[model samples]
Structure formats: C-alpha cells, structure tokens
Target: MTADDHALALALADAAGAAIRPFFRGAWSEERKADRSFVTEADRAAEAAMRALIEAHRPADGIIGEEYGTRNEGAGRQWVLDPIDGTTSFIAGRAIFGTLIALVQDGWPVLGVIDQPIAQERWVGRIGEGTTFNGRPAATRPLKDLSDAVLGTTTPHQFAGDDVDAFMGVARAVAESKIIYGGDCYNYGLVASGHIDCVIEAGLKLHDFAALVPVVEGAGGMMSDWMGNPLDAGSDGRVIALGDPARLDDILDAMS
Candidate 1:
C-alpha cells in the first residue's frame, strides 16, 4: 500500500465516524437481519459515507462492506469495511464499538484500522510496519504462558457445535477470572494495545476479521486460525490472536 492508500483508509474511518456519532445514544431505526444480527440506521449511514468516499477517491478499487454489498468485485485491491462492528454495544450506548477498515491486496490484508469514534481512539497498521495507536507506536505485551494470560472473546454464543467445547478447553486452561466476554472487535484492539493477552473467536466473516490481522500482528502480536494457519480472504472464521507468538502452540493445543 502506498502513503496515499493509508491516508484514504484513515479518511474512510473518519467519514464513518462522523456519520455515526449523531445516532449514538440517540433514537434511531434498527432492524434484525435474517441472521438475527441487528443493523441500525447508524450502521447504514456510516457505511454509506465510507462508500461514497471510496467511490470518489478510488473508483477503480473494490469495496466489501457490512451494510452495503460489494462493488468492483474483480479489482485487485479491495477495501473491506464494517461500519459498526459491535452494533449491540452501540445500541446499548457503549463506546466499545468500532469502525473497521482494511485494504486487502490480492486477497491478503495489507493495511488495517480500528477506529473507536466515541473515544477518538484509532489504531492503524500496515504490512511490515509497526502499529500506531492515536499516532504513537503500539506494541503487544509479553506473555510466557497461558496460565498468566488474560483471554477474551465476544461471546460464547458465537461458537456452535464442537467449537464451543474447543473454546471451553482454552478458557479452562487460563486462570480463573482471567476470561472476559463481550467486546467484539474492541477486544482485538485491546490485544493489539497489549491490554489483553489473547482473543479467540469463531464464526467471523471476512469483513469481521480482515482489519484485525494487520493491527494485531503489526503490534508485535500474531493472528491465525485455530489450526495455526495464516488468515486470508478465504479463512473459515475461527481466529486466534496472541500477544506473544511463543504461546501459539499452547493455545492451539488447548483449543484442540
């Protein structure tokens, strides 16, 4: 990605944030999709704002967004966006929700940004570069063992079938009271910032996880599938983000 690409990604986040701030904590129309997930006016508005910017600034590039569908599907570089990653939290007036933006080149994420509009916190990451939180460098904290790790996930309900059992196994491996629930993408941002040791989640979509990989990995962390494979556009949605790469085997073993 070029410097201009990075700037455009940040601009997308800013546009989305501006579109969302007015509806936060204020009354807005909301509906449940076929998957039973909620979508609010704020979500559509934010995504519309971002889509407009992308179409104007980089009309040749593709876009895959949560609220709006894909455009320019055959383009080599695609912008992936989730206007409101934690819509439930946004509806509850929580600031933990974020706008996720990612630049995927040839199906691999090369740039990412997680923007918490309410708190004005932004984490930006690019391939082969350090992550930055609010314009300063960010790094993940060291962790020697799972026993010493603080683990997080959006919710246990996100898992189904054997995935539930797999997640429970990892949860059991960590110390009591060290597991946290319900932060969605914010939890991954925390992992990137070194505030959390790891986050394991399942059933995520491309838009849900594409932005997280760069942010976490660029901050000295690592992101992969449960089987320890690298993530890509075609990943099956079971994800593991570790603040310390040394714990990958232990985490994979615990999950298995």
Candidate 2:
C-alpha cells in the first residue's frame, strides 16, 4: 500500500467515527437483520460516510460493507467494513464496540483500522510495517504457557454445535477466570496492545475479521483459522488470534 492509501484508510476511520459518535448512547432507529443480528442508523450512516470518501478518493477500488452490499465487484482492491462490530454492546451504551475497516488486495488484507469512536481509541496496521495504537507503537505481550494466558471472545452464543465444543476446549485450557466476553472487535485491539493474549471465535463474516489480521500480526502476534491456516477471503469463518505465536500448537491441540 502507498502512503496515500494509508492516509485514506485513516480518513475512512475518521469519517466513520464522526458518523457513529452522534448515535452512541442516544436515541436512534434500530432493527434486526435477516440473520437476527442488530443494525442501527449509526451503522448505515458510518458506512455511507466511508463509502463516499472511498468513491471520491479511489473510485476504482471495490467495497464490501455490512449495511450496504458490494460495489465495483471483481476489482483487485476492496475495502471491507463493519461500521459497528458489536451492536449489542453499542446498544447497551458500551464503548467497546468498534468500527472495522480493511483494505484487501488480491484477496489478502494489506491494511486495517479498528476505531472505537466512543473511546477515541484507534489501531492502525499495514502489511510489512509495525502497528500503531493512537500513534504509539503497539506490541503483544509474550506468554510462556497456555495456563498463564488470558483469553477473550465476543460471546459464546456465536458458536454452535461443534464450534461450541471447540471454543470450550480452549477456554478450559486457559487459567480459571481468564476468559472475557463481550468485546467484539475491541478484543483484538486489546490483543494488539498486550492487554489480552488471544481471541477465538466462529461464524465471523469477512467484514467482521478482514481488518483484524493485519493489526494482530503487525503487533508481533498471529491470526489464522482454527486449523492454523492463514486467513484469506476463501477461508471459513472460524478464527484464532494469538498474542504469542508459540502457543498456537497448544491452542490448536486444545481446540481438537
């Protein structure tokens, strides 16, 4: 990615944050999506703002947004967005929900930004470069063993069938009372900042996770599918983000 691309990614996050701040903890329209997930006026507005800026700055690039469908299909570069990743947290007046933005090129994510407007915390990541949290360098904390690691995920309800069993296996391996719920995209940011060791989840869409890979990997961590494959557009929704890569095999063993 070029310097201008990075600038544009930050600008997109800024626009999305501005559009979402007015609705946080305030009155706004809300409804359930076909998937039974919640959607709000703020989500739509934030994505619209980002799309407008993308169109103005790089009309050739494509877009895949949660609120709005895809545009400029088949383009080599695409912007994937989730205006508010944790709608439940947002509806509950929490600041942990975040706006996720990603730039995917040739089916691989090259840049990502996770913006929590309410908290005014932002994490930016680019391939081949270090990650930054609010302009400061960000890095994950090292852990020597799974028993000492802290784990996080948005909710156990997101898992079902075998996915639930797999998640429980990982939870059981971690220290007692070390698992946290209800951070959504914010949890990955915490992983990047060394405040959380890992996050595991399933049924995530491209918009839900496209931005997380770069941020976590750039901060000396690793993100992959449940079976330890690199995440790309074609991978299944199962995800694992680890602050300490050495623990991957242990986590995978636990999952199995």
Candidate 3:
C-alpha cells in the first residue's frame, strides 16, 4: 500500500469515527450478546459502513468483524475490524473506546489503523513501511527495567480464585503496575504508539488482537501470553505485551 492507500483508510476511519460520535452525546439502543457484553447500535452502524468501504475498495479482500462475523473466505488477503471495541464504555459515554482495522496479506499483517475518534487520534502502521501517528513517525518509549516500569490491565473482578491468585501472583512481582479498567482495545493501540508501556489481560479474541500485533511490533513492542507465546493456544484470552523484549522473561516469570 502506498501513501495514497493509507490516506484512503484514514478517510474511512475518519468517517466511521464521525458516525460513532453522535451516539457519544446521546443515548443509543443496546443489546446484550450471548457473552453478556453490551453491543450498541453504533457498533453495528460503524462496521456496516466500514465493510461497505472495504468491499468497494478491495472487492476480493476477506473481512472478519466483531459484530458481523467473517466473510469472503480466502487465504491471501484479509481485513480485521472491530468497529466499536468498547461498546460498554461507549454506551456509558467513556472516551477509552475506539475503532480498529487491520489488513493482513498472506499470513502477516501489512497495515493497521486504530482511530480513536473521540480523542482525535489515528495510529497507523504498515509492515516494513514503519508506523506513524497521524502521519508522524512513532516509536515505543525507551524500555525500562521490569522493576521500574508501569503495566496496565483491565478489571480484576472478572477473575476467579485461582485466576485471581495467578493474576496477583504476577502483580506482586511487578515493580509497579495498575489495573486500568475500561480501555477496551484502545489500550493496545496506545501501547503500539508508545503511549503505554505494557499490558497483560485476559478475555480477548482474534478480532480483539489481530489488528494489534503488527502495530505494536512496528512500534518496537512484543506481545504474547503467559507461555511466552502468541495468544493462539486455543484456550482463553490471557495475553501479555511489553515494550522491551529484554523484560519479556521477567514478565513471563511473574505470570508463572
């Protein structure tokens, strides 16, 4: 993809962002998913509009979305999207939610877009082309020793006894960490662009993560699970990411 294609995606994200903003000020109807999570009308609208744009631009491209599920089954090129990652927060009028889009070629991510419309921020990354924030080059912050870094995770109440024990087990070892709830997927985008240092959390899916890997890597970060592997173990969504590979072992040790 050239600068022009990136520009087009930016425009698409901007439009989708605009569509989500009105729901921001006023209340929108919502429904509960089977998982008991809230899904607002904005999610449906944003993904629909995003899907139309991708179809018109890349007719042959595959699409996997949170609200609408998967379409255009092929192995060559694919687009992953989460129109409104934090619908619960968006419905509650929180600013942490955002839109995510990723284009994957062959088996790897080639381009990613994370547009937080409310915050007026666009984080973009194209493999080999480097990563940028609103057209400016972006990089992760200088990695600090594990003993002096900040880690962000979501709600802890969702964990059970053993889960809570395991989570706190890691927390106790961290030099300093905070469980910042309600970020939805925006935290990953923030980490990709170096706004956050590391994030370890549970409960995620491919759509929750696919758009994040390349952007974070493009910004010089590494993400994995408790086993020091990608979250492809086919179990739960326990995942971890760090801005420094040097501290990966430490993070893993704490998780263990």
Candidate 4:
C-alpha cells in the first residue's frame, strides 16, 4: 500500500473510534452470541462505520469484521476489523479496550492500527515501516531474560482445554510480580510502546489478532502462533507475543 492508502486506513480507524466513543461509560444494549461471548451495540455501530468508510474509499477491497460478516470474499486485498477488541473491559468502564484495524494483502498483514478512542491514543504500523504511537515512533524494550519479562493477557479464563496449561506454564517462567491481567488489545499496544514484555492468549479469531501483527512487529517485537511460526491468515488461535525476537524459542518451548 502507498502512503495514501495507509492514511485512509488510519482515517477508517478514526471513524470507528468516533462510532464507539459515545457508547463508552454510557448504558447500551448487550447480547450473547452463540459462543456465549458478549456483543454490544457499540461493537456493531463501530464496525458499521468502519465498513462504510472502507466501502466508500476502497470499494473493491474486501472486509472481514467482528460484528458484520465477510464481503467480497475472493478479493486479494482485505481489511480485518475488531470494532471493540476488549468488550469486557469496555463494559466494565476500563480504558484498556481498543478498536483493531488491519489490512491484509494476499493473506499477509501489511498495515495495522490499535486505537483507544476514549484515551485518544492510536498506534499505526505497516510492513517494513516502524510502528508509531499517536504519530510518534514507537519501539519495544529489549528483553534481557525470561525471568525479568513483564507479561500480560486479557484473561486466563479465556484459555480453554490445554491452552490454560500452556499459558500458565509460560507464565511460571516469568516474574510473577511483573504479570498483568485484563488489558485486551491495550496490552499489545503496551508491548509496542515498551510497557509490556509479552502477551499470550488462546481462542482468538483472525480479526482478534490480524490487526496486531504489524503494530507489534514493526515496533521490534515478534508475534506468532505458539509453535513459533510467523502469524498469517492460517495461524491457529493460540498466540504468543514477545518484545524481543530472540526469546521466541524460549517462549514456545515454555508453552510446549
């Protein structure tokens, strides 16, 4: 994508942020989907706004959103969106929730944004370009050792079956005092901005993580599936994020 396309992506994220801001800290209807996860009117409205923007500017590009289903399925270039990545946190009146937007071309992520509408902070990243936090360059801190790493996850409860054991086993290797819980997509932004060292979680869909790849990686962190494979359209739901790329083998081994 060119500079103009990148700017368009960011603008779409801004629109999504605007669509969700009014619903935050305000009463709104919520419902449970077939998977028993919560969804809100804000989620739907935010996605709708994003979709509208994308359709208007890039009519041929496809879209895969959390609230709305996929469209233009065969289009090689597609946008993956999660209007409210941390709905649980959003509902609880926390500022850690975010809207995730990613552009995938030929099944590879080329651009991504994590926007916290309430806090008015946004992280933008793209292939071969470094990440930027609110338009300033963002970079992660180097990891000296696994034991000193600051770890984060939205919640361990979302881990299912062997995932719980996999995630906890990795956590045990890091300093217990440095672990943080319940920060949704905010945790990934923290990784990009040098606040967190790692984030591991399971059961994520494509939209749940596609938007995070560039932001984390462009900031000098490495994001991948638990097997230490680079993330792409086909990755399994389990994910591991490390601020330092050299720690990928250690993290994967710990989880295994």
- Reference-based lDDT, each prediction: 0.95, 0.94, 0.75, 0.91
Clashing pairs in 3: none
Q: What digit string (tens of lDDT, one per residue) describes model 3 on residues 52-147?
A: 888888787788888998888664777778898777778777888889887766656567788889988877877676677777877877666665
Give lDDT for model 4.
Answer: 0.91
Q: lDDT ranking from best to worst?
A: 1, 2, 4, 3
- Alpha-carbon error at 34 in model 1, in Å? 1.5
RMSD of every candidate to native, in Å, equals: 0.6, 0.7, 2.4, 1.0
Summarize candidate 2's per-residue lDDT along 1-256 as a digit string, tens digits: 8999999999999999999999999999999989998999999999999999999999999999999999998999999999999999999998999999999999999999999998899999999999999999999999998988899998888899998889999999988789898899999999999999989999999999999999999999999999999999887999999999999999999999
lDDT of 1 by residue, 1-256 (tens): 9999999998999999999999999989999998899999999999999999999999999999998899999999999999999999999999999999999999999999999999999999998999999999999999987998999999999899999989999999999799999998899889999999999999999999999999999999999999999999999999999999999999989988
User: Model 3 reaches what TM-score against the true structure?
Assistant: 0.89
Model 4 TM-score on a 0 to 1 scale = 0.97
Q: Is candidate 1 or candidate 4 better by lDDT?
A: 1
- Candidate 2, residue 45: Cα displacement in angstroms equals 0.5
Backbone N/Cα/C clashes per model: 0, 0, 0, 0
Of models 1 and 3, which has the larger lDDT? 1
The better candidate by TM-score, 3 or 4, is 4
